[model samples]
Target: MDLIIRKYGGTSVGSIEKIKKIAQKTKDDINNNKKILIVVSAMGNSTDELLEKANQISKSPNQRELDLLMSSGEIISSTLLSMALQEIGVQSKSLTGFQAGIDTNTIYGQAEIQSINNDRIINEIKKGNTLVIAGFQGFNENLEITTLGRGGSDTTAVAIAASLKASVCEIYTDVKGIYTADPRIVKNAKKLDFLAYEDMLELANFGAKMHPRSIELGMYYKIPLIIKSSNDQEDGTLVCNSKDIKNLINKGIIMNNITENRNRVSGVTSEGNISKITLKNIPDKPGIAAKVFEPLSVSGINVDVIVQNISNKNKTDLTFTIDDKDFDKTIKTLEKESLKIKYESIMSGKDYGKISIIGSGIQNAPGYAAKFFDTLSKINVNIEMITTSDIRITCLIKNDDLDKALIKVHEVFELDK
Candidate 1:
């Protein structure tokens, strides 16, 4: 029998009735002679509510206690789902990530999975029982409960699929699947039947809710996934292990999620609430840049969009993107480098938005950039910044004009049609 791994998001198992529907689905799979493993997120918004409650009690809650508290949401859902399955006369067992042996690092909020043992899961499957797993949370080396941060359930499902070598991992969400653009933004946006890992990664990074880290796990394990709406039978998009799909001409219409009035060179995406650290003068020496960023690297603060301007009179300006979440840590790390480099100033603003338009055709079309800018110029939109890659173009625009910018740029490329 083929092994099947299915994951239901919070909305999918939000209530007892919904849990019953899930249990029935699992029973259907079992009756069809498939070995089943189901991973489920907490009931709708339960985790968020829990966090809100925690924040109510404490301005800064202890990470370990918060992890333990947050994990209970999923644990409750898993057990409820299991009970629901039993009520339907289907044999099933509920498992937490720890019980399932998903060993992870000690990071309390955003722990990374080190490995997953499948012995217990495999045995349950052999016994003709469907296994229900609490997703998103795992246990650390200290055996303390820890969570894998936002979209962690998606990551959990993929990680479990990898461990068990399941045929395919199914992601049941509110939407049918990946669309040409977010359906909310583009009503006529078509649903994509398939996508490559890289495109999905880009889409996820650009506000697609499917989550980039889960896609990363799927790619690493070469696992195929179906992103479908939990409420329907519509055949959702299948993300597969095929480079062939990425090669198809105009395989998908990727939307640039930015708004501006005037057309510029290309699309732009910028994260405001981002900081820029300029290490000036650094003796105009080699290894200086490396020395400045090495501490940041160790602290795991991801630096994005690095730019080094030409040194005027043997002085340079360095700018990189680190969001508000890491802003405090980034400043702390830079303090250590203060002795080595005398910089002008550390600056940040929460006044910008990152906008990007992604497609594979840009590299071959020499005039695409000019056309993009001309369109913006015609509309009187002023661009703040711009960046490009072989297949994509991005820009920074005023957050207020983001919607107008996206629609106009989308229209310029005839992306909507």
Candidate 2:
């Protein structure tokens, strides 16, 4: 019998009726002789509500306690859904992340799953019961409760599917499936029937709703996934191995990231939290480049888009970007080395956006960069920071102009009709 892992997001089990609907789906799968494992998220904004409640109680909730509190939402949903399954004559059980043997690192608010020992789950499934597992939260080496960050539930589902070697992991969400563009933003945007894990990563990284990190986990284990709607029976996008995408090109989607109205490039993506610090008045020598960033490097700040230019007779401007989440701590750590590097000043902003145009055919075309910039030029969107890989070109732009810029570039690139 093939093991089928179905992961339902919050909206899928938000009410008794919705749970009943899911039970019907489960019964169909069971009748087909498919052993089942179900993963579930907190119901209908429960996690968000829990976060809001935590904020109301404390300005800075302890990370460990926060994980403990937030995990309950998923527990609630899993148990309720399990109850619904039994009400319909299906044998079912709900297990917490720990009970299901999800072992992770010690990180309280952002733990990564280290391993999954599925002994207990296997025993239960062998006894003719469908197992419903809670998502997002996990247990550490010392058995401490931990939580995975935003969209971690998706990661949880993929991880379980991989561990059990399930035929496919089904992710039920609010939409029919992954679209070329957000349907709400672009009415004509079409859904992708299939997508490569790498392409899905680019789409998710470039602002698509699907979680990129979960896609990464799926790729690691060569697990196939179907992203479908919880409210209906519409087929969802399938994410699978490279072999599954062998004969495909032009995968029915294009994205354009434009920041400002200057028009240097199209589909530029930028994150504003990255502060660029230029250490000035340093000796204009080759090795001098290493002096400024040494402290940030030691502090483990991953810098992006580094640029150095000779400013005068004996000095140069050094600029780079780091994640905004770590911006404050990085700056605090750098203060100690200010005198060593003789840095002039530091500038930071959280009002930037990262824009990119993602497509499989991009790497095959020559002069693609020129064509991209030309399209942006016609639209007058300004470019801030630029980065690229063989398949993607990303730029940073102002947050205020992001919407108009994205739409114009998408149209310019013929991403939508």
Candidate 3:
């Protein structure tokens, strides 16, 4: 018997009708002799609604209590979906994250998954019953409820699939699959039938809908992941290792047999809600960089796109970008540590966004970076900061110009065609 894991996002199980549709799909799978394990997120905007309710009661709610309150949404979803399945004559069982044996670190929110004891899951599957597990929330070493951050459910699904060594992990979302660009922003964006795990990871990290941690887990476990729409059966994008992709290309299975250009640009992505902070004229000493970032790390704030220039007069400026939501906390943290770090001044900028282009072998392709900047220049868009890796090149620009920049870059790569 082949075992598989499938995860549906909030919008997928947002209503009773959608849940019934999912039940029918699962029943069909069961009849096909597939042992299925399902993971579901909170229905619709229930998570957001719950958070709003918490905020209405207290300005700064306790993190531990907040996690406990937020986790209820997924419980509601998993149980309701299980009821729907039973109503349709399908034998099913609903399990919370803890009940399914998901154990994590002690962090209340944004907890890292430490391990999964699959004994309970294995026992449930052995009974010939479909197991529906709640996503996003898990238990810590102290056995307290903890919630994974945004897109945490995806991580949960991938982690479980890896633990159980399932055949495949399927992620059902609102979109058909990964695209050359966000279709909403670039109307002509084309869907990619296949993507390398590394490319997918870069895209997710740069602001695609898929979670970066989930992609990382898939890559580590060599698990094949499929991303498609929940509303319909469509050939969605397959994400796996580059070796697998190359094998398919050699067999004339992908991209119309144009393997020669396999190393070309894959996609362009943009992320808004960015804020940049620069610590000006800090002493260019060995421990200065550590001093600046360690506090932010301990405070649970993620820093991105760091750049430090050459030392001038034994002093240099350190700049980095972070999610706008963390801007205020970051400022406050730095303000409290100013006397110790001893920087000349602290400056901040908001309304900035990042645009990136990713592919497998883009670094070896000559003129790609030059061409990227040239395209932006043609549109009168100004680039603020630049970063690059072997597979990606990123530029910072004004948030107002992000849409125009995306369209121009997507066209330059001819991704729409």
Candidate 4:
């Protein structure tokens, strides 16, 4: 039998009522004679709640213990889902990450999945059982449990799908597929029916709802993923290769986008809670940046949008941005190596946000950058820093102006149309 991988996010199975509905949906799929492997995240905000509890106990809870505590949230949802399935007269069983044979590296909080031994999963499928496997948490080399951090469940679902070589992976979330701009912020943001993996990856990296890592896995594995709302009947968006079968269903959605002008720019995205840090008066020598950032690299802090001022008197200023959560960690890391880095001063601020335009080769094409800059200028939004890739153009600006900036740029490009 052909196998399908269906992943329900935390909100999708948050309550008893929703879990029962999911149980019914599973029954419907089984009635159609299709086998499914269900992957699930923790219910509602249980993971956050658990983390809050850990914080109450100790400000710095041990990483291994924290992983242990957080894994319980997913375990609760998976077991409840399996019980609901069984109560509805369906043959189903719940499995934790270890039970599901997901092996990862030694990292406790953000472990990378090394491999997945799906022998047990295959056996369960052979016995006509629908397995409700917990997402996010997995085992390390020594059998210690680990959790994949931030968007971990989505990563887990895609990784499992790739390992099984399943037909497709369906990710059910609260949103009705991907949008041209954030619907909550921009009321008229359009729902995309399909997207090229590259376009989706850029959008997600900038500010789209789905995680970039999940999109990356799908792109690398050539796995077709459907992202849709679990709460309603809205159509889902499929992310896959542009040359995939979607061209047959919606031939012009991506192919003739530029010529038709319906979607001149594929989407606009904005991300807040960013902190920009600048190291002033450093020697303008090669490898100076490497020396300064190596500690942060070792600490796994993601740095973006590096800008170096021209050398004056053989000294230059270096600036970069990172997520707000890592602001203190990065500051301390730099300070600890202050003598080695030999910088004059540290300047940092938390009032920054990034606004980006994403599409198929929009960055490479002329005039898109001009249109973006012009639109922001009319709104009095000053661009602090700018970065570009083959398909994305990003601008760092004041956090307060992100909403207005996104709307104006979306309108300028006619993405809502």
Candidate 3 similarity to native, TM-score: 0.96
Q: What is the lDDT of candidate 2?
A: 0.74
Please report, in order, the local distance difference test score of every candidate based on alpha carbons.
Answer: 0.75, 0.74, 0.90, 0.88
lDDT tens readout by residue for model 1, 22-50? 88987886786767789999999999999
RMSD of 3: 2.6
Candidate 2's C-alpha runs over 4 A off are: 245-342
Q: Per-prediction RMSD in angstroms?
A: 5.8, 6.2, 2.6, 3.0
The CA lDDT at 306 in model 3 is: 99
- For candidate 3, give the lDDT of residue 94: 96
Across 267-315, the per-residue lDDT of candidate 3 in tens digits comes to 9999998999999999999999888999999999999999999999999
Per-residue lDDT, model 3, residue 162, is 98
Which scores greater on lDDT, model 1 or model 2? Answer: 1
Candidate 1's TM-score reads 0.85
Residue 11, model 2: Cα distance from true site in angstroms = 2.6
What's the C-alpha lDDT at position 272 in model 4?
Answer: 95
Q: Give the TM-score of candidate 4.
A: 0.95
Who is ahead in TM-score, 3 or 4?
3
Model 1: residue 70 alpha-carbon error in angstroms = 1.5
